[model samples]
Target: MTDSLTLRRPDDWHLHLRDGDMLRAVLPETARHFARAIIMPNLVPPVVTGADALAYQARILAALPDGMMFEPLMTLYLTEDTDPDDMRAAHASGLIKAVKLYPAGATTNSASGVRDFARVQPVLDAMAEIGLPLCLHGEVTDHDVDIFDREAVFIDKILDPLRRATPGLKVTMEHITTKDAVDYARAQDDSLGATITTHHLVINRNHILVGGIKPHYYCLPVAKREEHRLALVEAATSGEARFFLGTDSAPHSDDLKENACGCAGCFTATNTMSILAEVFEAAGALDKLEAFASLNGPAHYGLPVNQDTITLRRTPASYPEKIITGVGEVTVFDPGFPLNWSVLPSSV
Candidate 1:
């Protein structure tokens, strides 16, 4: 058995590090392992302009703890009123890496998301022209559609037509949770890629309600059935450049998550590396872990791979179940199985 493995430090292609105290509490969890991350822009006001993105980036930097080295790859939250010229300036200045599309009412803090796809055509055209990528929440908010079917339905009703209409507009179907999504991504051209969350690969819908209501397992683009989880495992371990890691490590307070109307998110930043190692090793694809976690995301974004490296050793370990933040405790994602693979302390 391979006792230890080492590879380039990974970057989170999609992540949600909310602003203020929550941001400071959770940023270290990701920074401890990941060299950089594509920071989500769904803050209360949302980062909608180049100025908004720049200000948010400065806050993230200011929140970083002493001696920690990390980079925040900023993104703009696409709204119906999003100014294409502002987007162009952000991209030209290299402050923003992509534009996030959250269908109206699709996910947390997405009230400002686009409802009319036609209204955003000019922005989409500009993005395609400039070679900028669009990150999608990838679910429809139609009241008639079953929650489980939203993802597939959105692909057919929205994503397919949009891609066809805006040729060469790079799209990232973020936190994909279904076999249909996997198949769609496989069928699409190189301009289309998808991000698989660390939590989705480990849990299924049953994990949330099989025995009792497990709120922490809940997240936007919620986990699907075992069959879908298996497909995510297959695709993630297949070394397909179009599929990569994006932890989507959203953090919500314990009080909020435990309430009757809890928010959607899983705080997986704490143990994502360890859990990812376990998942890859189970599929006997340890050799391909680097490609999925580190190489592919940067390639898809037209960026360089991280130079630092992290090592994982085959040693059983347990992580805390909750993280204490100023607001309240945040529950950590439980992989259910004891992790035999653990990331060693950083060496680079």
Candidate 2:
């Protein structure tokens, strides 16, 4: 194995940098590690149009610390009422990079999501025409489907059909957490890709309930069984161009997380690179780190690879337990133990 690995500065193809004070607090963590991030649109009302996306992007820019070079690639939240003409204009204007699909009640702040696939065909057709990627939160919200089986069911019932319907559309299966997702993405041509979250690679469903309910481990597309985790590790380390890093490092306030109805997301941005490096190292595929972390994402998105480089070393590191947001402190997903790998900025 190489003693060190260097990669083009990675882009977080999927991320959630919430608005207002929360934005100010968490943007720096993501900015410190990623060159660019595809910001999620599931805010209070959601960013549904080009105008809202541009305004949101401005707020993100204003929140960034000076001299901290990080680009926030914005997206519009797809809803039944989303106007196809507006979406086409947004992509053409270069104000938006993607359109996120969150089936109603699929995850946090997604209550306004689309209820039926047929209702949003116009917007999807427009995206296909314009060459914009559709980022999906792939879970069927049917109450009868076992929570663990939601992803696989969605793959059969929604994603596959959607892809067949819009054959020309580019798609990124975001934070994919199942073996089916891995297989589906890999079977596709380069036009389709998948983003694997750091947490999903390292933790399984047991991590959430093993020792009482660990809210920090709770995330949408919630962690799956060990077999699925192994599948993700294999897909991520396979050096396949379809797999890339998209740390869905969503942060929720501790109160919101530890209460009766805990929120659905893990605050992993603070230690994502470290966790990723550890997983890749253990699999004896450290050599393939750069492609998963850097190259594949930009290539799929049709953007040039970043010129700068970042290094991951076999060094010990510790992350804070929580971040102080204006509403309240947010719990981070560190296991409260030192990590075996650490990411250090490098001048390339």
Candidate 3:
């Protein structure tokens, strides 16, 4: 059995660090393990302009504890009113790394998301021309579409058509939950990539609904059937460059999560690396874990891989049951199995 492994530090291609007290509390968990992350812009007001992204980036840096360094690769939220020229300046100035599309009402704080795809064609054209990636929530909000089928439907109805109409608009199908998405991403060329969350690799619809309503297991692009879950695991462990880790580690207070009409997200930053190690080891593809978690995302985003490395040693992992923020307590994700690998302390 492998006892220890070392690889370049990983980066989370998708993450949500809500503003204020919540941000301060959860920022450290991810910074400890990742060298950087593609910060989500779905704040209450949403970061839609270059200035908004700059301010949000500042807040993220301020919240980051001293003595620890992390780069927040900020992104702009795509609204129908989004200004293409603003996006160009932001990317050119290195204030933003990508743009996010939420498909209005698709998930939390997505009210500002686009409802008219046509209105954003200008922005899409700008992105394609500049080589800036567009990260999509990858779900449609049509009430007629069954919740479970939303992702597949979005691919056929929205993504395919959009990509066809606007070629070269680099897209990352964020938090993909279906095999249809996997096949679609594979059929495409290098311009397209997909992100698989750590929780999605481990849980399925059964984990959320079987015994009882497990809110902590709940998340947007919600877990799908057992077959879908198995497919996700395979793609993530297959050493495919287009497939990478984007934990989508959204955090909600315990009170908000455990209530009627609870929010959609899972707080996984505290234990994602450990959970990923367990999943890859079980798949007998431990060797490929580095590519999925560390190498693949940077390659897709046109960024250099981190120079530092984190070593994971075989051992039981320990993490908090709840992270107490000023707003409320946020529960850590439970993988339903004891993790046997952990990030060892970096040697100075």
Candidate 4:
């Protein structure tokens, strides 16, 4: 058996690092393995302008633990009032990498998201012209739509129409959890890409509802049926350029998660690489790991891959059940199985 594997350092195409105390608590976990990450912009009030992105970027850098390095690729939250000129400036200045669209009320802190698709056409048009990508929370908010069908329905009713209308726009369907999403992304041109979350690839709907409710397994774009989970694994392990890693490692205090209406997220930033190594190795696709986790994201974003490297060993490793942060203790995502691969000390 292959005992150890080394690859170029990976980049998370989609991540959530909340600001202030929460940011300080979680930043090091991600920075330890990933060289960079596309930072999500869903904080309270949201980051809607170039200035907000710059300020947030500075804060992320300041909060980084000494000797640890990480680059924050900022994104702007798309709202009805989002200024096209500001987006252009942000993209041109290299502060913002993409614009995120969270159909109003779609996910956490998304009350400020876009309600009318027509209202943002100008911004979409400008983004298309400038070659900026759009990172989407690919689910609908219609009250009548079954929670499980929201993703598939969004593709047919919204994403398809939007792409038809905007000829050159680049779109990254974030944390896609359905076979329909997988097929849609596979059929699209190079302008399109999809990020498969670490947790989505590891858990399925049954993991959440099987033995009483497992709140830690719950996340937005909630894990689908086993069939869908299989599809995601196939795509992610296939070495397909359109599919890559995006550990939407959102952290919520244990108090918030165990309460009546818990927040949607999975805290996997701490062990994503190790878990991924196990998944890929299980699929007999260990050769494709680097492409999925390290190469594809940068190619899609028009950036260079990291020069650093990390190694994964076949030896067993143990991780904490929960991490104590200044805000509160946050539970780590449990894979529900023994992890045989563990990330070794950094090579760079």
lDDT agreement with native, every candidate: 0.93, 0.90, 0.94, 0.94
The true-versus-predicted C-alpha distance at residue 206 of model 4, in Å, is 1.0
lDDT of 3: 0.94
| Candidate 1 residue-pair clash tally | 0
Worst 10 residues of 1 by lDDT: 339-348
**Candidate 4 vs. true structure, TM-score:** 0.99
Q: What would the per-residue lDDT of candidate 3 be over residues 1-348, giving only the tens digit for each residue?
A: 999999889899999999999999999999999989999999988899999999999899999999887999999999999888989999999889999999999999999998999999999999999999999999999999999999999999999999999998899999999989999999999999999999999999999998889999989888999899999999999999999999999999999999998999999999999999999999999999999999999999999988888999998889999999999999999999998898974632
The pairs that clash in candidate 4 are none
| Candidate 2 collision pairs | none
Which lDDT tens digits does candidate 4 get at residues 1-348? 789888999999999999889999999999989999999999887999999999999999999999997999999999999999999999999899999999999988999998899999999999999999999999999999999999999999999999999999999999999999999999999999999999999999999998699989989988889999999999999999999999999999999999889988999999898899889988999999999999999999999999989999988878888888999999999998788888865766
1-348: candidate 2 lDDT, tens digit per residue:
555678788889999999999999999999898999999999998999899999999999999999899999989999999989888888889889999999999999999998989999888888898899999999999999999999999999999999999979999999999998998887888889999998888889898998799888899898999999999999999999999999899988988889888998888888888888888888988888889989999999999999998887777877777899898898888754458777889877
Give each model a TM-score: 0.99, 0.97, 0.99, 0.99
Regions of model 1 farther than 4 Å from truth? none
Q: Model 2 Cα displacement at 316 (Å)? A: 1.3
Q: lDDT of candidate 2?
A: 0.90
Deviation of model 3 at 26, angstroms? 0.2
